[model samples]
Target chain A: MFDFNIVTQWLDTLLMSFLPAWATVLIECVLVALAIITLYAVFAIVMIYMERKVCAWFQCRLGPDRVGPWGLLQVFCDVLKMMTKEIVNFRKTDQLLHRAAPFLVVTASMVTFSCLPWNKGAQIIDFNVGVFFFLAISSIGVVGILLAGWSANNKYSLIGAMRSGAQIISYELSIGMIMLAMICLTGTMSFSEICQQQENLGWNIIRGHVPAVLCFILYLIAGNAECNRGPFDMPEAESELTAGYHTEYSGMDFGYYYLAEYMNLFICAGIAATIFLGGWAAPLIPDWEMWNEIMLYVPGFVWFLMKVFFVLMLLLWERWTFPRLRIDQLLNLEWKYMLPMTMALLVVMAICVSFGFIWN
Target chain B: MENKSYFSGLFSGIKSLCTGLKVTGRELFTKKVTERYPENRKNNTVSERFRGVLAMPHNENNEHKCVGCGICEMNCPNGTIKVESEMVEVDGKKKKQLVRYIYDHGSCIYCMLCTRSCPHGAITFQPEFESAVFSREALVKQLNKPGSKCAEKPAPARPAVAPKPATTADVTTPVAPAAPESDDKVAKLVAAAKKAADNAAAAKVAAEEAAAKAAAAPEDADLKAAADEAAAKAAKLAIVADNVAKKVAEAQA
Candidate 1:
């Protein structure tokens, strides 16, 4: 779909001739890593600005409007500010863990982006069990949050870390079950294969019918909670925790956590878009090959970005509109409300699949 | 019953949330109520009486109403508005003209006391509200133009003392009737009057001699009656002379 593969192939042949087999592989991995990091930085700038603009619009305000034309340069100016700010040292704290925590967080989010498909066959990795790997890898961000809180040696950070741990663990189960429902329908553990299944069998949200719709809603709610955003963002709740686990962090140290949170949001939105909205696949308009050709002229990456940003806007709308959930209420929402419903929907879908009622 | 209530409560929560989204969604499509700030300055307006900063307004001819009485300087609570006036030759007169109306906008509190107390209404707070600037010195500006006086006024146009010059010149220059400064001229005129009185007495005696000769030669009753009428006229003239001396003495007092 893009010239990225052509460049990758050229680099692979060039690296292979100059170095040993393993060294060439290592060099390729380094290149991909560099590309993902660059994407992460760009994604953070765009997402932060979008979030601020969305929040401002909901409240009838013009957000960040003085930096450049319509405040387009605000993110760059803020990043510069964060980079130049001094990192403050904590008294009587675990220095090593504190230093390693932000790196761990940013790394986890960057790794998650590797599994997401930007266009057809343009993903960084196409490993089998990509969904399982993504689920497992994304949960590791909470460990960084916990480390940052514990190593800071502050009471609020510790409480926030504990809350985040509980919140992520609670939401992860429902998200897992919802994904399981969608996964059974696709009958695969690989992302590319799963995306291809949707393309062949009409997108899962339509293929799985009502069950897919239920899963989509439940998945978004759980995903929102999983990222600790909006009503579910109790751990780093501004009113309660004064900014949660990274309270003691200053400068780029705090900025790393911020970047991680936004990256997590984008990946979640992208995953939602990929699994449900047909990753980079144009909307089907049957019996019109000319129309299909016209749509493809717009490119798959633009469609992918449109769907991703649409999902991101949905998340932002909920964040700005909903009030913060209390810690007990957050857990109650998962265990009492979402879990039982997810289980019932799974049983109903299993029976439908066995009976051969499910169709594209 | 309990299970139904739980389901109902969840439904109600979702419904309320949907309601909130509806309001926000409706507003999203509606025209934004927020100003784009610097872009919106063209449309917005300050209040009619909003005193943003002190300013001296000039007419099209580059003239203002300030006569440089320093009244606004005295009326300002913070002494923010200073009037620096140099005496200039306007119309061949040493008139106190306004060289500079120093309006220190940085220190102004906008109390409206200076505008209210300005007698000629020369200085006022204009409705232009975008007064913020980078430096304090940029706010200090000379308001009135140096070359011209007020359009609605002549030179030295202090309202309190404007009419005094013309009226006082008319009253003082016309007469020394009640002034002691003209005493020397009055005394020289009185000496001249006494000499004129002696000459008149000598002329009257000569005329009386000529009249006696004519009367004695004619020897007629009609001529004797004419002499009696002349004696009566002389008596009336003597009465007028007594009143003039009395009036002159009263003026000297």
Candidate 2:
């Protein structure tokens, strides 16, 4: 009922009829860019607020409730405060790379966000290698993190950046293998195609049974590690590294990193929603036509968001619940355990896919 | 066995993680412990014993318990308290009255010495923690309100274990009541005790006087009579002293 394609299509057609083709394409690009930026701002504000509340609730404390009703406008106030703050410059720092780092990280997050199939016909870019594209773009953020750390001319930043580099790089393997296993089941790397296939094949987790479930669990673990959130947040270990890679960052420069972190969380959850949980697909009750019909009537956009938020909550739950892992333990978890498990699971998924043992 | 242990270890690790999540999950829906201060100031309460600031409480009649003994000032390690007093005529008698009970809250370590050391229980810590002020002078508070009078009735002093009664009637009342004949006997005993006490005192004075006169006039005839009189007095005083000690021991028993 609330499909966003109708508005987007109408806008596209309206612009096409009144303007030149080049100008129309340019306007569409500008609109999409504006939409993505606006989405980033909204998500950053929302996720930060949600995370604070979740963290507070877990600790038996009431979170922010002063700025606006339920502290809804707290993030906006924080943004304003951050904007007016002085981006302090260090004497011996590499000014150029330090300045460019936040932009790079934010750009990487935005690019990855565009690749996700938000709803049917609502995706910004429907790349054939969408999953691979997401993986590639997301890893580019680590480069920005490393640059920020190294250029800060500080020991803490250097160590934090180095730790982040090691953790993200290693965990990326497990993440890739899990996605590969999913792709093996669906026979496509394109997120939209995988999502559509899951709708027909009764959600990959349901169809592939054991291996798929294993894939989902491993993917959450790997994705969590990839995001550099606890229990895998070794680089920006606040207790040890004093905000890790972004130690020297201040003002809106630091705000970018902060925004990107939350946005990265959304992206991680979004990927999980698209791959394992059927992106934009309404949850159906087996053998219950009435329930299926009712669920199907709800907008795909709403379903997509519900799944994303569910995954986001799971990530938030674990983040608040678990303590930060030691650096050695982090690396050991990936290399000795998660990576090997993903590899074994990928093989099992391959066999299941070849034997046509899927549920649907 | 090795493989079994490995799998069990992994399973237990995941289970432990789930257990942690469950604890926080349960806490998430539980009632939050946050007290929104300032907004909830109306509902906020502090412990009765919370030492926030020194205050001398006044009754409805605006009378305080401070006697201005300066004990609190003496006990204060940081010179946080200053108790000043002035002698004022009350019913034609000079009485030390509290003029200013200056309490420098700025310098107060909140060691509770001032409150604990107040002999009259005059000063106590009031749980009014919002004592922040802009001016340094504001922290130096005068605990005694202006135009307030000192409480007329002092707090009752602690009772002692034993008391000395002056009269026979007073002594008999503290002890168990006896027969009417015993009351008369007690009175006569008390009269005799009083006489013995006076004679002992007189003998002591005479003995001293005789000794001094003997030392002055070695060949005087009256010196022998005076010595003899002193010796007789001493002997009688000794007898009286023994009888008084026996009566005192009997009374105690």
Candidate 3:
């Protein structure tokens, strides 16, 4: 009932009736790009507000409640304030790279977010190597950080950028390994195909069982570490690095960086939801026919959002609960602990996939 | 031994992480302790002894205990208190009468020395704290309300018995023999406040009439100018009225 493809198809026909095919295609591209940007910005705003509220709740305090009702408009006011602030730059800074850094970061996040399968046939880009594309695109954010830090000619920014570069590079291995473990079980790199397989197979987590759950946990850790969130947030360690790689940035430039960070969190949560927790697949009982029928009545997009927010909550929970890990401990955890665990889990996943020991 | 310790350490570390999660998770649903200031201002309580600002206790009759002793002014370390007193003839006797009790809240350190050292106990700290203002001049307050009399007669101008206990029954005596020029100034301020308010009301009515005229003659430049002029006059008069009303309140307070 909530299939978005039908609406898109109707619009497609209406546009085709009036416009040339090339123009129609160009306009559709622009529309999708605009939609993706809007989604990215909206998710950033929601996630930031959610993070604050969740953090406040965790600490046994009322968060922002003075701006609007329950302080819902606080973020909008914050955005306005940030947008109007004077953009300051150091005279010695590399003007071009410094200017381009925030945009690059935002673009990287925006590109990765567009590939997410929100519902049945609602993906903007159905890339053949969808999982790999997300992995590759997400890493470009660190490059932006490095550019911002190096361009600023500030010691703290440079150190922060270097640390982030190191942290993301190391964690990327664990993320890739964990995804590989899932890939072994699901037998597809395309996100939609993986999700579709989860429909009948009763979610890769239940199908692959032990190894899948291990991969899920490990993937969350890797995702949190990669996002530079707390516990693994050695790069933007405010106690030491002030504001880290974007220390020199101000006004909307700094705002873009902030937006990109939260967007990255959402992207990570979305990926985890799609891969491990059954993207838009509703949870069903094995023997209850009536229950299965009831589950099918709810829309897939809502299920997708539920799973994504659940994962997002877990990420934020981990962030606020744990203290920041030292840089040494961060790399040590990745190389020593997370890496070995994923490798062993990958082998176990391969055995499960080969033996047909998964649920159907 | 090393492998056993390593594996045990891993399990323990995982357990501790879970314990931390459980702690924070439990806290998530617990009662929040935020004060929600501004929203809960009525229920919010400051300590009774909280030295917010100094204020003179004027009785229901608008009479204060300060007999222009100036001891509170001398005890103020920051010179925050400036007690202006003048000689006045009451019952054909010259007595020191308080004209103004200027208290600079911005400079006051809240030391309470002025409140404590007052022999007559004329002033004390009030708990009314939300005293923020835009300008520094607003922080400097005239504590004694305008035209308020001393609670008692000046004790027959006895210099030796300056710390005599105030008698409320003595309020039947003649109040401050206010100088003629000071009385004229107060009258002038009250007149100005009334005049400004009337001018604002007149300008508003004129603007409304001009707006109606402009509506009738859409293409008339002169009519529009008249309307704009009337609106401007109303706006200026409204501001003047606001200032004068504030001055009137200050005078009365």
Candidate 4:
């Protein structure tokens, strides 16, 4: 026998024992950040190509087949082209905020990944208030957008940024309320604790009855809006405002903002997977302990990636199929429709929890 | 009408979401229609009849049929044709021959007129239309082959008819001959007079027809009705003059 398990367990024990707590935390943070950034970059590149191909397929045209194999490297080539292009900065822009905005947005997006519980033992920071921390940190990116818009001295950019700020803030309420309902059911704010709670109580999605499903759906919509994704992407309305808030950005700054948008998408997908899909918990089967033991051999990070990619695909599918909403329509959806409906769902969920309908 | 309750409305939203998801789910598995072009171009070839570029055809003798006849040049609505004739020695006699027949493919409308108008039967449609080129000069085709002149064909000769022999009975009949000669002279004079009269009548008729055509040209409504009836009997070809010009330019290119 090779005795692989013994060696692995020994190595794990040695590392856990020998490493200083602070150093471990620092190393883990750097590793996770690097992983998220890498994943985000790859996902953005792939998604851009996928979107173009999907559009071409729908429209009955062959898309970008000349660049690389099946045009997979077309986006990379386009990125290179963009990199070589001159960065045109208008003379009237506020030199400081206009330049700093993209970095701020990207930084905020990167930080949100810190709280995402990829799997049972795989997370950058498994803090007690992980959900709240993610929400708080993610919201700050909107300020950067607003600042960029205001500093650009462009009327369209300013309007777009203002709209985005209002929209994200408005949608955050419904999203926060829905998450609160999940928190109430789970009885913990820590992401890993939430995942463990679901495993113990058989997925909050199914355990908390019908209303929980409604809350989950509500969370998805709110999250989509928060990311300024389709149906709610009025702020970056390409048709009307060119590129909206980032209309003035060029070169690497523009790329950073673009990267940040996708990173936000990645974070949103991670949150959805963690909160509702039971993290990396395998479906219960007979000989559950044995199955859990087998599952442990498969790294938790891989399962987390699978779940996130699935959610991301779903988001992209929604983006491509649906027509974008008008600014007025977006506001109406939030204040008039989503807000009241989510409130009702929350009330129903709370009632269901009180009546012992949630956990048996 | 009874108003729907808030709970029912909420249920409707859920139903719509499910419907949306179902639609997306169906599309996710549907065969992707991405045709990787360049790889698939050989299989998905365009039809031969597809109008791409215009090419001019040379005759069997490699001589152009243009004959310096500016019919195509005149007929082209878009000034795409440029024909230049030069005086050259043909069979030891100076003759005006078509030197340059330059057709701009870029400006050609592909109307096919030039091929139709080539009286010498030199120009024809070649059907090799893929004329994409980098320079403007490449688009202008000089149709005249180097060191070649228009080949002239000789006219065919007419055959002679045999005369009938005069009989002795015809010679003996003096009275008949005198009467017949006078009659023949009178008849000849009469015939000449009749011929002159007929010529005058024909001239009048032709003049009347020309006047009628000129007058009727403006009043197209009545003229079209009459023309249609006449055309039905004569089987006149409905040739669009502009389209013919375009085709000629395309062929020349």
Candidate 5:
């Protein structure tokens, strides 16, 4: 981002000199939004490729190898294929919502990125109620999924959307609880502030002890559930729902659901890194100035990516390894098991925070 | 149910999931079951008993064991095999020889009926199952060479019965005459037949005398004498054939 930083600074100075301040800010905001969209597309492609390779390895099979080396270009080729395919609509459907559903889903997922902390000062916006906004905006994607299913007038899609709505709403409780646990530990809602606080302390996982680790585990399961992936992927259960909400979708509309799904997974993993695993923060060896200085040679963005990839690997590992949980089982697990467990962990964590046991 | 508490049940569920994950994690190191087909074709070998296409077993001399008996063709349920034979001159004698052995591979359902029904152990199932063809015509193959005849021939025992002509006549007479005719016609027929019979008898007696003489004579001279006697016998048979033809013509008139 050297040139990107330089070019953006140059544009800002140029705009400030010539254009009205409001117009300059407005155009700059649009450019940043556009950049976020591009990031979503690129991140979706990378995650999809990684998923294919990792899932293949888990099953003792070779993944795509025909395109670029180790099939790195497979996603690009798939994108081309999806773009060229005709978007087929069904006989009886609400054309407006059916067509609008995917973009809505994608936008909901993309908006959450404005509050994400990639590195120190690398966030798009530092909202005072950032964590709340993240939770609220991300959950809005369920509406898109519901509309996708309901608008298509497909029974399977309707069931899928309904499941997605239920699953996301249920899992949202546990995910928010885990975030609250982290928030309690960090004492901030802004992503960069939370991350900076983690840098001050070691990490929430270390300071909050066992409860923090439990919170991490609970978050992993619920976040995966929220994204509607394997194991927790009952809504899009291919055997059950065909494609869940996106069954009637074709061509790029179908592609959009996939993009949103995988990109959502990426953010979930990124957030996990940010909250529990200490996003972009290397472990500190205190009183060793030489080693610390050498460690600084590694960029924070790379550390962020490495942590994200680790989380992704965990997601992939769990997906390939486990059979899908039944609908009743999924609800029961969340309501009966994860909900109570996460709530208990949060109370434990709150005690730890109050007693000054968690390092500031 | 074990009546387990919520915490205990949750722990057990996660434990089971972890166990399954462990299995897949171990499998991550295992070799894959799929072989890229076209690239790995050279490494493939079908089993010995694999029934692919019908073929005839040929010796090192390029001579196949199929005798054009049409037994395989008859036994084929789908009419896939077609055997056609025609009379051909071989070794100066007219013999029924194999003209074509058309095998329609497209119609063959890989039923080993044709291979099993062959009496001479002639048909075999060649294990070459990459048998896709561009056109149906490409699958219809001729399995034998042109004018291919059976290797085994039976021709030498006709004269051995001359010593027991009474029995031989009983077996041979009715085979030629289908009706009772007028006395003159019967006499002519008998005369013509008797002349033919006398010629065969004389030839037999001469053959026996020549055999005895050859046994007593020197080796080189005996072979020359045998060759001369064979020519004389062949000529006498030609004369008999002409007299029989005249007798048949007279009867028709």
Candidate 6:
């Protein structure tokens, strides 16, 4: 009989026999780094095209249809253009920090994917404190924004950086508290374990009571603010700040920052799907015997992508529909509204856990 | 109340998100509207009154009636026209021939003043205004018709003046008969003066009536002001009444 446990044990034994511990670790790190980079690049390109198309649709025009059958290569042409352009560093700027900011920001976002559980047994590093590690590492992107804003030597960038500092720091609390509620219900910080727990009980969204759902919604909003996405993208408000933190970044330097943003978006959505929607869990199909037989042929990375893509589409839809939140409005939504709401939800979730309202 | 359950807000948030999704879903299927610029430009036609380059028309006789009079040159406010006249010998008589009538279409305001001021029935406005060109020199147009010779001339001018009348004795012989004629003329002049005086009196009466009507303008203005104030007050009262009715309906519900 092909039990899931034996399958894992056999694979572990085979891996141990063939490779040294350090060599195996090295291979995994290399593979994960390659996958993350490749995925980020692909998504960033696709997202740019999608955004243009969405904008065009809303404004009542056909977008990018001529490039290569619906303007798929439009982003490529744009990227090529941007790559060839000159990077102009202004006379008044902290050259060192200005140069280093985007690279660091993008690197920070890329590093978060190292701990995410792609599928059942597919992950770069199955760290025990995976969720915490992701939270800790991804928040470092704010440093990039701060560096970009301060080093540009423009007042708009400085003000934008300051606003970003306030925004990320505030929204992070609500996001953290919301994630903490999930941690309470799941009783683990490991993303894979959390997903596994959900598989045992339909989905955390359905199983973990009303407060957990509230936490999920709050986390989504806070995550949006953290990434400086619409309704919360005050950092790069073109109308108010002429591109906010990256006002001075041009050519490939600007491109790097842009790529990092979309990369962060994918990473955030991946985390959200893993935490709430039961990552790669086949839902309500009822043909488990057939699914189990075919599941092996389908790679874990593909499942991860399927789930991530769905979440990305949802996020894009949100971006198109919602009007952006003002800076003061954004902060109030965080400190006054989201923080308190998430805190109360956490308390309620705690009560539900103690009373066995979950998994009943 | 028992800490009104806060899940209501969460439910509302989910509801709003669903509503947004529905809207986007509908939009995804709608036909797109885009004007392909190059394609449209190939078939595009401009309106008749598009105000393009100005042109002056020449007659069927292959002759421009420009008399070298320089009226068009003087009337062109922008100095877009230059008319040069030359003294040419026609049949051994001197005449002013129009050597050149140059028009710079670039500076023309399309005011049609030059066309209107041609006193010799020379030029008329033409509607063929599409005169965009690459070079500035291409915009300059020569008004003179090709191979057209200058018209022949007449002789020079002559002034006419007469001698003054004689005085005293010449006046005495004619003055005796002229005296009676002068009396009759004086009476006719007196009659004409009386009729003029009557017309002046009638005109004065009409002027007084006009002045009286002008004096009543302020009263009409005051009446209109009062009417406007009443209408504004009525609109405000209607708005207040509507608000009250809405509140009453809510209370009843």
Top DockQ prediction, candidate number: 2
Tell me the DockQ of each model, to 2 decimals. Answer: 0.34, 0.64, 0.61, 0.15, 0.50, 0.30
- Ranked by lDDT, the better of candidates 5 and 6 is 5
What tens digits encode model 1's per-residue C-alpha lDDT throughout B1-253? Answer: 3555788989988899999888887756666667666777878866778777677777888777888989889988887877877787867968776767888888888888888898888888887778889999999888876676756555564443333323222322223344455577565444433333333343344446556855796877776666666655444443443344444455556
Candidate 4 runs further than 4 Å off: A1-65, A78-91, A286-297, B1-37, B47-49, B55-76, B81-103, B109-130, B141-253
Standalone chain B TM-score for every prediction: 0.48, 0.54, 0.48, 0.43, 0.47, 0.40
Worst 10 residues of 5 chain A by lDDT: A1-10
User: Each model's number of backbone clashes?
Assistant: 0, 0, 1, 17, 0, 0
Question: What DockQ does candidate 2 score?
Answer: 0.64
Arrange candidates by lDDT, descending.
Answer: 3, 2, 5, 1, 6, 4
A1-360 per-residue lDDT for model 1 (tens digits): 343467677888998988999999988888878888888899999999999988888887777888899899999999999999999997788999999999998888888988898777678877788889989999889899999999999999999999999999888889888878777777787787776676566787887888889888888888899888987889988877898899999999999999989989999999998888888777666677888678767666788899999999888888888889899989999999999989888887787777766867
- The candidate that achieves the highest TM-score relative to the unseen native structure: 2
Q: Which pairs of residues collide in candidate 5?
A: none
Q: What ranges in model 6 sit over 4 Å off? A: A1-28, A90-92, A285-300, B1-25, B36-253
Compose the digit string of candidate 6's lDDT tens values, residues A201-257: 666777785886777767777877888888788988899999899999999999988
What local lDDT score does residue A194 receive in model 4, on the 0 to 100 scale? Answer: 88
* TM-score for the A-chain in each candidate structure: 0.95, 0.96, 0.97, 0.87, 0.95, 0.88
Residues B144-250, model 4: lDDT tens digits: 77766666655431111111112211221222224334444444443333333333333334444555774669667766565455444322211222233233333
Better of 3 and 6 by lDDT: 3
lDDT of 2 by residue, A330-349 (tens): 99888988988999998999
TM-score of 4: 0.67
Report the CA-based lDDT of candidate 2 relative to the real structure: 0.85
TM per model? 0.67, 0.76, 0.69, 0.67, 0.72, 0.62
| lDDT, candidate 4, A20-119, per-residue tens | 8777667656765687778667877876786677555444455677877878889999889778877778999998889888878988887886677655
Candidate 4 residue-wise lDDT at A350: 76
Greater TM-score among 3 and 6 belongs to: 3
Alpha-carbon lDDT of model 5 = 0.80
Clashes of 3: 1
